[model samples]
Structures are given as C-alpha cells and as structure tokens.
Target: MPNSDYSARHLSVLEGLDAVRKRPGMYIGSTDSRGLMHCLWEIIDNSVDEALAGHGNQIDIVLHADTSVEVSDRARGIPVDIEPKTGLSGVEVVFTKLHAGGKFGSGSYAASGGLHGVGASVVNALSQRLDVQVDRDGKTYAMSFRRGEPGVFDDATGISPSNPFKPFEDASVLREVGKVAKGVSGTRVRYWSDPQIFIKDAVFASEELFSRARQTAFLVPGLAIGIEDRRGQEIAKHDFKYDGGIAEFVEYLAKDAALTATWKLSGSGDFNETVPVLDESGNMVSREVSRKCDVDIAVRWGTGYDTEVKSFVNIIATPKGGTHIAGFEQSVLKVLRSQVEANARKLKAGNDKVEKEDALAGLTAVVTVRLAEPQFEGQTKEILGTPAVKNIVANVVSKALLEKFNSPKRDDKSQAALLLEKVVAEMKSRISARTHKETQRRKNALESSSLPTKLVDCRTQETAGSELFIVEGDSALGTAKLARDSEFQALLPIRGKILNVQKASVSDMLSNTECASIIQVLGAGSGRSFDLDVARYGKVILMSDADVDGAHIRTLLLTLFFRYMRPLVEAGRVFAAVPPLHRVEVINAGSKANEVIYTYSQAELEELLSKLAKAGKKYKEPIQRYKGLGEMDADQLAETTMDRSRRTLRRVRVEDAAAAEAMFELLMGNDVAPRRDFIIDSADGFERERIDA
Candidate 1:
C-alpha cells in the first residue's frame, strides 16, 4: 500500500491565474493608488515571508524609471527545477497557479500574511509585464512575461541542470565585485502595471511606500529594508532592527501630553480618597494601589472635543476593533466609576453623566493585543474578529486596575481626585448645553422655525435620499433655488467662511451667522446628541468660490463636521461641490436667439477657442471664467454643482480620526510650535506655499 499522508490530501486542485484579472478588486480591493500600492505589498509580502521563515535578512524596494516597482530580497530564491509531480518549474507554478507557494506547507512559514499563496499569482495576472530573475545554482535564470503570458524564452547562466536549486551569484554583479560565486542567493521581481487594467489611474506614491516600509522596519526587528526612487536616488534610508521589539512599539503608541512634562493639568483638589481594599490574597487589606499592567495609559486635552481610540491586533491596525477594544472601554468606564464613587462628595456637580466618551474627549489611545492566532474579518482585514481575545484582554486590564486599587504604595489618590473635578466640569457643561439645545429643537419644531432666512427650502417631495447644496453667496443661492428640483434638492447659501469650530467653543459657534444658517437648515441638532439619521438631506454639498478663500471655507466646514458630527463623515454623506471654473458663449449673425456655449475650465475654454479658430469661426461674444459660484446662471448652476447626475462631489473621510483630531488641534488651536512643525513636516505634500498665513 502507498504511504498516503496529509500533505497529499491538502493539495489545492484549482489552477491558473485567470480569476485574478477577471475580478481584480477581489484580490487587491480596487484599481487605484491604494491598489497600486497593494501590488507592491503583495511582492514585498513574499520577501517578508522569507524573513519570517528565517531565510532572509535584507530586502530592497525600488521605483524604476519606467513606472515599474522592483523588489529584491537576499533569500533562498524560488526553485527553478521541474517539480517531480507536475513536471513544472517552481517559479512557473508560483506565478501561474493560485495557492501554489510553499508558505502553505506545515513548516514553511510559521506566520505570514499570504497564507493561501495567492499573492504572487494575483500580482502576475494584473501586471502588464513582469521580469523574474533568480540567483541560484551558481547561475542566474531569468524569465519575462506580458500580462501573465510567457515571453521570449527562459535564459540561464552556466550551471549544471542536475543541481538546479544550488546557491546564488548573479554572475555580472559578482564579477563587478571582483569575487567568485560564493553561493549567496536571492530573488528579484520587477513588474509594470497594465494601463488597460489601471485605466482610471494607478500610480506609485514613493512617500506612502516609504511610510509602509518604515512600518515594516518597525514591525520586524532585526530586518533591514532599503528603498530607492526611480532615479536610484536614496530618498529614505533607514535600518530599523529593534531588539526591544513590541515594547518599543508600545512606547511609541503611548505618547501624549499627559505622559510628558507638558501636561497642562496640575491642580490642587480639596478631597482625597482613603479606601481599604482586599489584596489578591483576599484576607490582607492594603492601602497602597498601583495599576500593575504597563499599559502605559496616556491622555491629552486637545483644543477640540473629539475622541479617537485606535486598537491593534498583532501590529496590524484594527480601526474598527472588536472584543479586545470592548474590554478596554469597559475597563476605562470601571476605573472612572470607581474614582467618581470614591470622590462623589468632592465632585463639584453632575459628574455621573459624563460617560466614557466624555472622559476620552480629545483622547488618543492605542491598545495592542498579542494572541496566538488573531482572527481578522473580511478581505480588508481592518478589524479584529477574534472571540477569545476579549476575555484575555479584559482579565489582564481588570486585574491590573484592581491591583492598583489595593497597592501598598498607591499614589492614584491625587490623580483620581483631579479626574473627578474634570468629570464634574464636563457634566455641568453637558447639562446646560443639553437644556439649551433641547429648547432650541422644540422651538424649531414648533415654529416654521426661523430656518435660516437665506435658506431656500425646497419642498419635501419625498423622504427618500435627497441632497442639499450649501453654496456661497445669495446669487448662487437664488439660482440654485430656481433651478433645483425643490422637492429633492434644497439650497442653503452662506455669506462667507463659517466659524473655525476647531478653535472655537460651542458658545462661540452660535454667534457665527453662517454656521447658524447651516445648523438651522440641517434640522439635525448638533453637539453631544447629534444623530445623523435625522439630518434633512442624505448628502451635504459644500459649494464655495474657486480661489484660496473657498478652500479655507471648505477646510473649516470639514473641521466642523469632523469635530462635532464625526458619524456623519463616517457614514459617507458629506461631499464637496465641484462647479465649472469657466463658461463660454458662442454667437453668429442670424443664429438661434438662445445661442450659447459651455466650457468648464481654462483648458476647456482654450480648447474651444482653438477649435473655433481652426474652423475660421468667430464668437461675437466672449467667454467668462467664474471665480465664484455667484457668477453662474440657474441652469448652469444646476448642471455643474447642483444636479446629482452631472455634479462632482468630493466625499470627506476620517481615515485616521485620531490623527485627524490631532491635526485640527495643532493647526487651529493655540499651539504654535506643533502647528509650525506640522506645516514643515507636511510641506512637501501641501500645495499652498503659505498654508498658515
């Protein structure tokens, strides 16, 4: 009888690279800059697998002049010999067959991102041309492909066919170094993205690539990765090999104002807590308390009132966390409740209502969990879906807090006392604000409600998903009011830039006429208890001028929504209005009485004139470039920035809410140094020369 084993039973029967190209989005998410980066990541993942296998130490990523990404690694190159079972080369099987790589084996790689072995094949199917060069067997074997099809033929250096997968030495480079082949081996892959597949647009972003490279540099200690641009010019060259590993990651993630001397809150509270708690022994009582877990808790009071809590599962960011995140939140609430109950008499007033979110206002947290096998949900893998991780994390944190409460050397008595004061302050504000906001809501609901005098409310044709265009100036407002399908499209016009809510308090915001107009029109109440579903329009379009001030106003509006109504931003209902920058009118003698022309921008205007000039035509009337939305007529306004079918809208995204909140505090708050440093750091990306000014 044949010795049959699990390896034979587990082999994948499916074949070919056709599925990837047919449904590329399934493999790489989408064909955009993000997807383009994903292609590089897939190849880099192969090298990372090698490192994880303890085979390679060095990896290099380069952007070639021809707009192709190249990744090289000093690892055991893919086997070039024919497989005994299928009579196919290892490199060919890897590139052409799905789930064909060795990482799927029991002992190939203990942990890897590409467990199913679909990375290389998927990349191959989506690429225009791929060049694979392997340094092995004292020879260099090279193969080329166009859109996953073999091209030209295979070329190889001098090496015996019997010993195919020997060692390395790309002969020319070895000769250049004046050394004989020393059996050092590796693999290199270069690929160009297919323009047909990337028709919309997919291009390499060197900076974002470097950022990811730096992430890998930090993730895997003792691993070196070097990145170079198309010009072979070293842009960012860093070797991150940290022996301290995750402890370093923890330290980096725990940075906040409270962790440093820059802590703004250092107050003298009147009350103190003296509670005797049983120790872990249960019999012995201790006055001392200490949070045993080195969770490195840090908090900062930003200029704005927003919360961003980021959690990670095994170094991978879980923006939308699961069980572990829930435990952390529960632990925080537990600590807050303990402190509040202990100092209930000392708390000024109304401290109970300020919940976890209140305590975490302008807060940034990083919760990292180390698990055996983290279960991630979905293809994007942005969330931790593990079931047992919850209990593990919760137990660790709860015990630590309990120990802290029973510590013999407890000093949290002072910290907890001050926190009670802060909670009370927030409580007072919440109560007053809630009352005031409720009264306004009732008044608005009772009366025709002084809905912004300038706001031209279109009839509610249907409660279906409709939109409202908040354009700048009364002229655009009037035009949009006339042209919009009143039932489905509402129009609200603002006088100028709305208040920068990032630097202003809720009270300060009420004074801004423009902001008030928006608030009144939205119908959905703002501040603490804002519900996005109650928003009058399914979408909000910010229509403004085409110049710098318009941009500033747009930023301000974005900031307001992000700081106050973040859920609205997350729901993807917010969008920017895109209107044409120019309009052209054509005229001829005895032509139609309603004769006119249309152009969108300077380029379009120039092109129209060039076409007319080529036809020896002359326009009796000239064209006009609209600097502001007020310049457009009702029909033009509806066609360009109002009509859902023709209009262009840019949706706002809180990709990193924590970073977004930090940005607002730094840019719009009273901190000058942080703002200056931010501008300097992002100078390369920021288009404006005088961003702050």
Candidate 2:
C-alpha cells in the first residue's frame, strides 16, 4: 500500500484532457439522458450566444446517421484572431481551457444562454470528435479534433470544393457559404458524442427539443426556427414565434382555462431581479460595489387549480428553483396579507381564510433572473443558490406590488385590483375548505381504519407484489377469498353499488362505506391522507366479470382510483384482470379432455368460427361467454384470473395526461353543460362496442 497522505502525490494533477474523459459527469452533469443532450446543447447554446449578440437569427440542427448531430448557425463565427496574452487563437482557448469564452468579457454577449464559459470546453473534452468552422473577414477557417488531436491540418481549404470533408456523405445537410453576403457571419459546429463518455443514448427526443425550441421562440420575438429528425421526419414543424413575447407566452399557458380578465396588464406573475452575489468572506469583498440591478416583472392571475411558477437564473429554467422562488413566495405572502388587512373584508372563515397554498392558488407566475456570475448547485443547473438574488427579488416584488395594489387607477387599475381581490377571496375559500375538509377527514380516519366487515382482509401486511382481487358481488368474492394467496393476496368484495368520488363531495366520499373500507385496508387512508408508501399491495388488480355490468363496475373503480388515489395509477400499481370471454375445449375426435382447452377474445371467437368454416370441422364448438364472475367457480377463478402465475393483468397507463385530465373533468366535474357537450361530440365518432352493452 502507498504511504498515507503523501505531500508529493498531492502536488501532481492529471495534465491535458484526461481529467474530463475520466469524470465526464463532473463537467456535463451526468452520463444520463440529460447530460447526453447537454453535449449537443453546449454547441447549440454557442449559436444561441451569437443570436444574443445580434449576429444572426437562422440556426439549423441536423441529427446524423450515427446518432451524432451537426449544428450550423448563421450567427457571427467565433473570433479566430490570436490573443495578445496567449499565442494560441481564441478558438483554441475556448475548446481546451475550462472557463475561457467571449461571455467572460463585456463585448462577447450581453443576454446569452447556457451556464457560462464552461459549456463548450466541457463538451469538446467529452466528445470523441469535434469539428469547428469559423468564417472571419474575407477568409474561412476550419479545424477538426479527435479528442484533442495534437497535430494541426495546415492550409485547410474550406473555400475549395475538392476537399473530402467539404462534400459530406449526406449532401443535403451542408449548404455552400456565400462569400459576398454582408451583415451575416457565424460559427458552425459539427460534432459526434463519444459513447465512451456518455452512457445514455445520444439520440435526441423531438418532444424535449420541442419544449426548449418553443420556450426560446417565445423569448426571442419573431425568430423562426425549422426542425427535422434523423430519418428526415418533418412532422410537428411549427414556428413558436410570439409577437407580444412573454406576454403572448402567458396567454398560451392560460389558453386551456378561463381567464377572468383580458389584456395582460404585464408579464403574468414573473418577478425577477439581478442582484450582486455577496462574498464578503472572500478577497473580492473589498472591491467597489455599485452594480445597479433590475428585476423584470410580469404577473397574471388566472382562475385555475394549481399555481404554476417558472423561474430562471439567466435564460435557463431553475426547475429546482433557488432563493429566487423562496423570495418571490415570501414577498407575495407579505404583500397580499398586508393588503388583505388594510382594504379587504374579514370574511366568514377564520383559520381557513389565509393559508400558504391558498395565497398562491390560481396564480400562474414566472420569475427569471440574470446575474454576472451565477452560482449553480450542480452542472445540470436545476437550481440557483446565490443568497442575495432571492432577498433582492423578494424585496423588489414586495415593494412594487405594494405600490400597485395600494395605488388604484381609473380604467385598468380596477381590473388589476379586482384580480388581486379575487386572489384573496379564493385563498380564503381554499383555506377554510382545506381546514374544514382536514378536520372531517381526521375524524373519519380515526373512526374507521381497518378493512370493512364485508371485505375478506388477508392475514399479512408485508404485501408488496401482492394482489388485491376486487371481485364483483359476494358470490365471486367468496370464491376468490377461498382461492387467494392469503400471504400476499387480499379479497375485497364490493356490494351492489359504490359511490363515485368524482361526482361526490369529500364528505359524501368519506361517507361511502365501501370506498372508506378500501382506504383503510390499503393502509393509505384516502383523500388528503393517502400516502403511496402505505399501499398494502404493489399490484391492485380489479377482477370483474366479462359482462357489461362488470365493465361498468371496472370503470367506476378505475374512476375512483384515478380521482382519489392517482399516485397508485401513476406508480403503475393499478391493473385490470383480463378474464377469458370464451372457454372452449375440443374433447372429441382428435383432442384429449383438458389438454385441448383454450381462451379467446370476442374478435378471436369470431375468427375461430370463420376458421372452423374454412377447415370443414362443422361440429359447432358452442362457446360460452361468461356473463358474470359467479359463473366461474373458485377453481376456475383461481386458475384463470386470480392465480399469481397465470393471471393476465393489464397495467393501466396514461399516455396523454392533459387529454386524460380533460376527459376525466368532462365526465366527472360539476359542470353538466361541458359533460353533455362532450357526450354529444364524442357520440358521433364513438365506437359502441367499446362501452358496456
């Protein structure tokens, strides 16, 4: 073994680019999907940097054959001039060094994207090959690297057509450079991600790209962006340009809901401020500080359920928002409470009148701040940790909002005031409702906790991978209870009817004996008290009959699970047991007794009849479709849909959350007109066979 803590060993550090390839995660964040995309994003951000500098607007990203991407932007090419201090060119410094880029100094860019200078160099270090082309003055320069390739390509003729690299294998991807084109210049970067560095697939997702592209288009007004995929898939190609910028972006967000007021008074609830990072403990503390900073505020209050606040440190979304989010919340609370005391009514509800969740409810807000040198938590840059920015932002928002709410106007001030007042009233209602609901739930939870007397509860509690066979009626429940794996499976025999929590209030839902029993048995007491961790079985299987009533019961159960215990569905814990519609056995000329039995779907049964006609086996199979679960005995239920080894369970998955939400809202919400309209609209195109007969 080496000597403990040698001073000589501490002095030595890995030279050149070995450090990055060895630990790529440290620089690019991770070798996962996020980091793999970040490798490409670094190059794209450079182009975005140029666009920020007023160089060019057009940018083209091409996903190549080998899953590598080629990003070409028409922005001003990176400066190729030799630096006075370092003999190497600026491009070399940008590629090789850690924190070297134009964004460091004043002239490079003012409002640029990405996490500062570390982006490009980190990407280059990780990439197996990075090829850069710069058009400067009357000359065009090109350089290629195979992971810091030492030797240089001398007299690179990019202006000439003879070179092999000039005419790429894919001819359509490359466009010839126009020499005489004035006021148009930029650096085009083409690079392949090293599989050795990133473990995640380098393949890009159009969905992820679409989100970023949409956000960028909204930020930069009137900028058109064209996108295409690897197989030249040109679907979903729409420019998300907003003439009104962030204002229009807010409207787009609020497009799905009802807005009480029209005309965005400002950016919808986006309060941001650029504050100087305090480092008094460091040597830089003594430096003169008079950096006048600003927080761009855009606010809009809409009538909605969830409060959506998106914040950014610079152009990047701080998903795990830092002090900025905290500060914004603090300010809003302070200002709102003050106004409530001074100008608003006392209202009916006391403790429920004011709550944290209540205050932010229905407030769709966005807060983004830019700093000289932002302190990020990690390379993925999900959070902004700078202490000063939050305090500054909160203070600014608080003061501005206080003034705005306090000082009312003639025409539009009333609208703004009314919105604020609505925010307060909503908060009051929410608080009172929440408190009242919680008190009732607590009382109910205490009153009844164990599975109901009607349900045959299993013995054991450690029920992960266990099955909860929700059999219809007492007859099927009796069979399932006798056949169930008592150690892992539980039987819940639902009565003739159960309450639909969707159409019922919290009180009514709690009152429903069947639903409440289920809440207790699952160990996750429902409504506000439901915790996914407390689930009795990992697999909650609904074993209904193959009849119309069974399907209706299944839908009702699904609706209950979706509305009240959604985390179960989201976690992939909910499942529908697929019982055989037809049980046919060939016990005649060619087949043995039990060996020739098989199950079939309705379509499959029809196909079987057709096949029998074709084959000339005209004995008439006489298939029996099960009308109820009781038709099948304990043994049949055990072997087909209840047996852990042979059961076919369809795991419910929500492909489109928004669409599913809309459907659920239409079918279940209090609004009858929307529900009626939905039925009317869907009835024309509806497939009658899908629903219960």
Candidate 3:
C-alpha cells in the first residue's frame, strides 16, 4: 500500500548547520556524555595542532563554575583579517561556517591532528554559547556566538581610528578591547554545551580529562599542558610536560611489570611515486612526486600475559589501529621469529618456531607517525589509511631490530638474547600444555567417550543455528530439557555454582570436573589457545533462576568465561537468558475464565494489576511469583524463557577493557575491605519491596 501523494517535492534540504543539529550522532557519534567529551576534544585539538606545528609550547585548560570550559594557548592567534572568498572575518567564519579553517589548502600547517577543519564549527553548532578572543599585532579582539550565530555587542567602544572597515558589520564581528604590550600573541576559547541536545547534563569528568591531557603531552614532546578545575570550593590543578615522548609513556606503562629491556627506534624517509600533471598542452603527464614521513617506536616486554599496543598519526590516537598497526605487528613477528630460531640453533635446542601471539605476549609498545598529508579512515580518525605508511614503518622497524639482534660483536648474554630466551620458554610451555590436553582427550575417549555424559545433545549439526544452554541445578535442567527445541537447542546441567576461576590458575581451573566438562562441551580450547572458529555453539547462553542465588551462580560462570575462555565472550557469543519473575491472573466481571499476564519486573506487575482494577475485572487473591525456574512446567517454561521468538537475552560485551578489569578485581578479588565498602554504598539504592525473599 504505497502512498500516492509522495513526490520529489516532499524531499527537504537542510542548509548550513541544520544538518549537524538534525543528525548529531553522524558527526560526534552519540548524544550521550561521550559526545560531550568529544565536543571538548574538538576544542582542545586546535590548541594541540598549534603545539604540533611548533608555534606554541604551553596549553592551559580551565573547567569553570557554570559547566563551561576555557582553553587557552600561547600560539599564533587565529587570523583576524577578512577572508576574500567569504567576505567575513577569519574568526567569525571559522566558528559559523563548516569546513572553514586553515588546515585544508592554506599550506599554513604541514602536519596537524585537526585535519578536517570542522572542529570549531561543529563545536559551535552544538554549544549553547561560545566566545573567542585573539591577541595579535598589539591589540586584543573579542567576538561571541549564540548557537552558531554571531552576536552583536550592545555598546561598542574603543575603535581604532586607522581601521579600514567597521567592527561588527561586513568585516569582523570582533571589536578591539585592550592593547597588547610587546610580544603577547595567542587564542582563547570558552564554550558551554546545549542541554537540550545531550542525554544528560554535560558534566565533564576530571580524571578522564586529565588522562587525555597527559597523553597529549606525552605524544608531543617539549609541550607543557596544564588543567585547572575551579568548579568546586577547592581548586585542583595539574601540569604535564614530557620530553622523552612515547618512550617515557612505554616505560610508565611497564613500571609495574617485570621488564627485560626497553628499546626505541626512529627514522624518516621520502616516498617517491608518480602523479598526474597537466602541462600547457592540456595533456595529463606522469610526474614524479615525493612525500616525507617520520616514524618513532618504543617497545618493552614484561612478565605478564597482556599485550598493550597504542598507535597514533600526527599526535592523534588511533585506537582501532589500521594499516600502521598491521605493519608493526608483521615487522615484530618477522624479527622475533628469526631471532628465536637463530638462538635455538646456537643452543642446540629442538626445532620449534614461535607464533605471533607468543612473541607479542607481555609486550608494551607505542607506534607513532607524522607525515605531510595523512589520509584517515573517517572523520573521527580512529585509523590511519595511508598505503605508503605501512611499508615505511615496517622497513624502518625491521632494519633496526636486525641490527640490534644480529650484530657480529653482540654478547651471548645481552638483552636481545634474554628476550629471545623468554619467548622460547613461552613457546615450549604452550606446546607442552596442548600436547597434555590432547593426551588426556585420547585417554578419556579410550576409556569411554570424550563428551560429557550430562550434556543433552542437539540434533542439528550446523553450528550457526545451534545453541547451548548451561542450566543450574537438576530441577531447572529437567524443565529446560523438556521445553527446549531438541532440533537446535541443547542443555547442560551443572551441579551447583562452578569454580571461581578468578583466583585459580589455568591448570587448577582445568582440573575441576565442572569447569572441565563445560570447556570440553564448548570445544574452543582455553586461555591463550582459545579460538572462536572452533566453538561448538553459535550462542552460549547461561540460564538461571530469577533469585539471589541464581545471580551468584551466574557471576561465577561469567568469571570462568572471562578468565579462561575470554575469546568466546570477546566474539559476542555469550548471552544471559532473562526469565519472567511474576504472573498475574485476571477474570472477567461475570465470566469464570481467567486471563494470564506475565511480567518481568515488579513495576510491570503493579501496572497490570492497576489496569485490571480500572477495567472492573475480578482477579485471584494472590499472584503467582516464580522463585526459581524449577517452578515452571514445560509449556510455561517454553512460553516464558526457552522459546527463541519470545525470550529476552542480554548480550555480554566489554566496552572498556580498563574499567572492566578494575570492576572484576574489586568484586571478585580477595580484598574484603573494598567489597564491603562497595556493598554498603550500593545498599541505599536497593529496593526491599522488589526482593521476593
């Protein structure tokens, strides 16, 4: 049933900054607190760009009392003259118009993080009010904006007699305020976010902002960055200035770990390629062109198992890691694998090659590149997409590693040899563990069967369509087995809460019967050997009762998956099945028939009862509440929790690795004081009316 009135006339056009307001997520990613942080980042990036171009050395950030922010830099201020094409002042144009900055084609900046030149305009559009002040040519100029529109001053004064144009009309929106002494030049920006556009009030987190400021100082050497929070009664301030750059960052990250050695490599080169050129004849001619690149790398290996690698382009963090990361990984793998093999030959060890994972384990490294023109993958710039950067970085790193490790006069007990030995030991340990697991599997098969006997297998052989439900207690298992669709759903019943693997080693975890059975059923291996491709089920769901004990059991199982079978959780294959907690029965005014309504929460139950009361429908005396899954019959269980079409499943994911790790440690570790304090703080929010017990 298509509408007959639809035509081309219905299409609407969004002009100027309206498109950004209509679709804020497309520009800043989201309208949550994260988007507010991105807005602050946009303003800070301009100051950072000035530092990168060697124009400034100091950046100061202030969090004001009115939820506004101010960023000041000791760099060349933004242009105060009129732009010929737009016929508007440079400062006014930069804040009001999109894609109007010095980065695009001005050639005023060779390498910079603010590549798109849309930061200032985007921030202005999303802000409620913004102000800009520039000090240049021994005079201070000021201008203001409200929601991306230039503001007019009520009483303007102190105009320069020699000035050619008016202060506020067609020339610059700025008016001269004060005279600068001799050599003071810079730009200052102050902005407040629009409350209507953000989900929550745009409140900045001090710790997160401080971390970013420190990281910027580390990325750009010889730059001083300071942060001041003046929103509270007691003002707090911190300063960061790092001259050692990324090398110091690596050392800081590896301070707590047992490091073998720390090394750094840096190089620069020209990328010569062919380009199209049009001569006087109007024919395209092939001409040789060259682009310059600078690369710096720092690496340190520790005794832990986590690998931390951060990459950047022109002082901008690239968390998603594109071609540059791939090149670095490849170069490290090649160099380490060769070094390990050579050492093995000299020591007369068996023929064993180190895998990429083993070589990179316990490694902390930072990769940075600066080029004349960097091509990023997107506006957010989470990845570097330049093709030549990959080869250049790989070549520089490989040559440096070879010279360091394969030198003729190198000592046998040098730092390189020590690192090689550690990597070899890791390789042998992994091989031995795999061999032992295979042997145990063979022995178990010879005795009877390798599969766990308690598992109720599914009929489908296709892994993509199959699901595995790990049920708690035999009572609930019986109901789930009867209710499940045997064609694609399988059930495995555990005795009780499984072992808490957070405090246990890998060997100890695998030795537990309950943990071992679940691992064998998953078929994805464990720990470092875990692979998503070998998983037996597409969705591994944990089904438990809707009670306190059920929550404890679920937590224990999650701990196991997070510690030993992390790849399964990381691949988005883990889920939690939520069952309804209450059931309401309503009867018509004169009829004996009853209408049943299932509610997942107490609020929903109250609403349902209220609606029935208003409809004048009589109901039973007491509603039936489910304490455990064992209370439901096969049909009831299928309708409430087991049916794929009707069931509600929550997918588990790790959005922030650092936060997740800290949370896990606080809740699962053996520290009693922190756990007690956390419970006490959270108890105030707990509603006793909702707890069935």
Best by the lDDT measure: 3
Give the clash count for each candidate: 6, 19, 0
> Which prediction has more favorable lDDT, 2 or 3?
3
Cα lDDT tens digits, model 3, 492-566, are: 999888887665544457678999888888776776776677677889999988888888899999888876677
> What digit string (tens of lDDT, one per residue) describes model 1 on residues 1-693?
011311221123112555677678877878898888877887997887688667888999878766777899989888888766555667767776776767543336544565247788778878867778887776677765555654332236522112222111121112111222668778899888877677556678877776667656556667788887755454445444555444444344432233111111111112122335445554545453221111222233333344556565444456788877887777666766676666677674533455775565544455665432345776655677755555556665666555544546545544444445555555554554454445434232246454556666665534356777778777767777767887677777777778878667555675677776676567565666566656767888888777778888888888778766778888888998777776655555575664456565555677888998998767755456677777778888878777778777888877887687677767776557988988788888875633311
Record all residue pairs in model 3 with backbone atoms less than 3 Å apart, i.e. clashing.
Answer: none
- Model 3 is weakest, by summed lDDT over 10 consecutive residues, at 5-14
The 10 consecutive residues of candidate 1 with the worst lDDT sum are 260-269
**lDDT, candidate 2, 604-670, per-residue tens:** 7667667767876544356666667777777777788878788778999877766776777667655
The lDDT for every candidate, in the order shown, is: 0.63, 0.63, 0.78
Off by over 4 Å in 3: 1-15, 153-171, 232-234, 272-289, 347-349, 407-413, 433-526, 530-693
Which segments of model 1 are wrong by more than 4 Å?
1-14, 49-58, 74-94, 100-105, 133-186, 221-225, 231-256, 259-304, 348-356, 370-374, 400-432, 442-693
What range of 10 consecutive residues in model 2 has the weakest lDDT sum? 166-175
Selected candidate, larger TM-score, 1 vs 2: 2
